[model samples]
Target: MRELELKYGCNPNQKPARIYMDEGELPITVLNGKPGYINFMDALNSWQLVKALKKATGLPAAASFKHVSPAGAALGTPLTEVEKQIYFADGFDTSPIACAYIKARGADRLCSYGDWAALSDVCDEATARFLAMEVSDGIIAPGYTDEALAILKTKKKGNYNVVQIDPNYEPAPIETRHIYGITFQQGYNNFEINESLLDNIVTENKELPEAARHDLLLALLTLKYTQSNSVCYVKNGQTIGVGAGQQSRIHCTRLAGSKADNWMLRQHPKVLGLQFVDNIRRPNRDNAIDVYISDEYEDVLAEGVWQETFKVKPEPLTREEKKAWIAQMHGVSVGSDAFFPFGDNVERARKSGVEYIAQPGGSIRDDNVIETCNKYGIVMAFTGMRLFHH
Candidate 1:
């Protein structure tokens, strides 16, 4: 089909929503459910992210997207036992793509709630089973197996949005959009991210290990599709945290750092051992655990709110405990879509265990930033490529 109409735009009041192609048929087919404007936005952007991830890593990839930004993205990697428990899949021999999707969706389940999913590889039964357990709006992938299609068809009472796109489809080099009767045009950003981008190591510690390089590539690929003024923290083939669309570089670092800290805090013994009521649902447990770990726990704890989510009054995860747990985190990689004008970004990222970094590295105070990395023995590379997205 050349065009597909939508029920509405970003909101219900916006009328006459549709997507079309000028010279050829649209590259996707809607197998189920009616996708909204925002759903399509999430799917298209996330699909690009996963596609880049898989191409960069030569592994299956997935992304959990909300609005137009990714909540998490990951490449296929073996999940630890603790990770399987938290992700709620303990006994399954998950496919590489399935594990990638689980890690992507599980990175921040709270943020991923009702998210749109995108997969790099064809959807398999294992991936469908994992998706079945999550709260999601829709999914977009290149293809789906028969078993996977059957399983996904049962989601959302058989109305789940399932989109299949041409794996080899590529858009024209230029793109255009309109806003308020004004048309905007630009060349599509097809900048390739690869090992060659990590050649310029300005830090005294000139060590971007193979794993660290892979993590750095993951972060850069994620930032390519993220909104402007974004930073991403990655570890072990997954984006642990992403801060997008911030005004200040330091704010981006701080925002992503806090999320990285939360990711680490979730694996803390106190958090992992929390005893919930026998029948507490996964979503409720996620919320309760987040609340228990936050500094605002006193507010949630004061009114006996814990009783609703936990069987017993679990010990509060105190600020001190949080600090101690975060301190132990290491081997993290950070990427910036643009240059860090000041050393403060480095200072904040270090607090969240960022040991390696990649950025365009043309700031006026590049020496200061390099000195800061030296203090922490952090290895940093100048990719010399800005990944600003809008």
Candidate 2:
């Protein structure tokens, strides 16, 4: 179809919304449900992200997007037992694509609620079964198997939005948009992210191991599609944290670092052993886990909130325990969408176990940033290319 009508624009009060191509049919077909403008925005942007990840890593890729920013993104890597439990993959058939999607959504379960999912590979039954259990808005992929399509059709009371994009389709180099009756145009961002960008090591530690390089590349690719003023933290092929659209670079670093710290804290034995009430909803369990990992867990437990989620009132993860667990977190890789103007960003990232970093490196305080990395023995590279997505 040349154009697809939508119920409304970004908000329901807005009127007359549709998407069309000037000279050719749209590259996507809406297999089910009427997706709104924001859904399509998320779908298209997330599609590009997973596609690039697969190309860069030669592995299946997936992304969880909320409001055009990815909550998480990851390549298909076998899930460890702890990973499988925390990600809710236990007892489910774990295909490569399924593992990628699980890890992506698992990166930040709180932010992934009602997310738009994107997969690099065709949706198979294995992936569909897992998506069926999550709270999501819709999904986009190159294609879907017959059984997978049938399963997805049952989600969201049979009104879930499912889109299939042509894998071979490419947009024109120049892109345009309209705002307040004014036209804006620019060449599409086609800068490729690969291992080559990590060549310029700027720290005392010049060793960029193969696994660290892969993590760095994954972080950079994720930042490429994330909102500007963003930072992403990656480990073991999946994004552990992403802070997007923050005004201050330090804020972005701290926000992402906090999320990374939480990811590590969840793997603690106490957290893994928490027993939720029978049939507790996935979202509720996720909420409980978040609160349990935070400093407020003691307060919440005193208020008797655990009765709602857990069968037994679990002991709170103490501040000291959280600190010790986070200290053990190492080998993380971080990427920035733009240059870091201060070394403080590096210092904050180091607290979250960041051992490798990738940034454009155009800051006036480059020496200071390099010095900070040296203090931590962190390996950092100046990619010389900013990935500022709107």
The candidate that achieves the highest lDDT relative to the unseen native structure: 2
Question: All candidates' TM-scores?
Answer: 0.98, 0.99
Candidate-wise lDDT, in order: 0.91, 0.94
Which pairs of residues have clashing backbones in candidate 2?
Answer: none
Instruction: Give each model's clash number.
Output: 0, 0
lDDT of 2 by residue, 106-149 (tens): 99999999999999999999999999999999999999999999
Candidate 2, residue 265: the lDDT equals 87
RMSD of 2: 0.7
Query: Considering summed lDDT, which 10 consecutive residues are worst modelled in model 2?
Result: 315-324
**Model 1 bad stretches (over 4 Å):** none
User: Per-residue lDDT for 1-390 in model 1, tens only?
Assistant: 999999999888999999999989999999989998899999999999998888888989999999798889998888998888777788776999999999998888889999999999999999998898788999999999999999999999999999999989999999998989999999999999999999999999997789999999999999999988999999999999999999999999998888888888888887888888897777887888788889999788888888888777888888888898999989999999999999999999999889999999999999999999999999999999999988
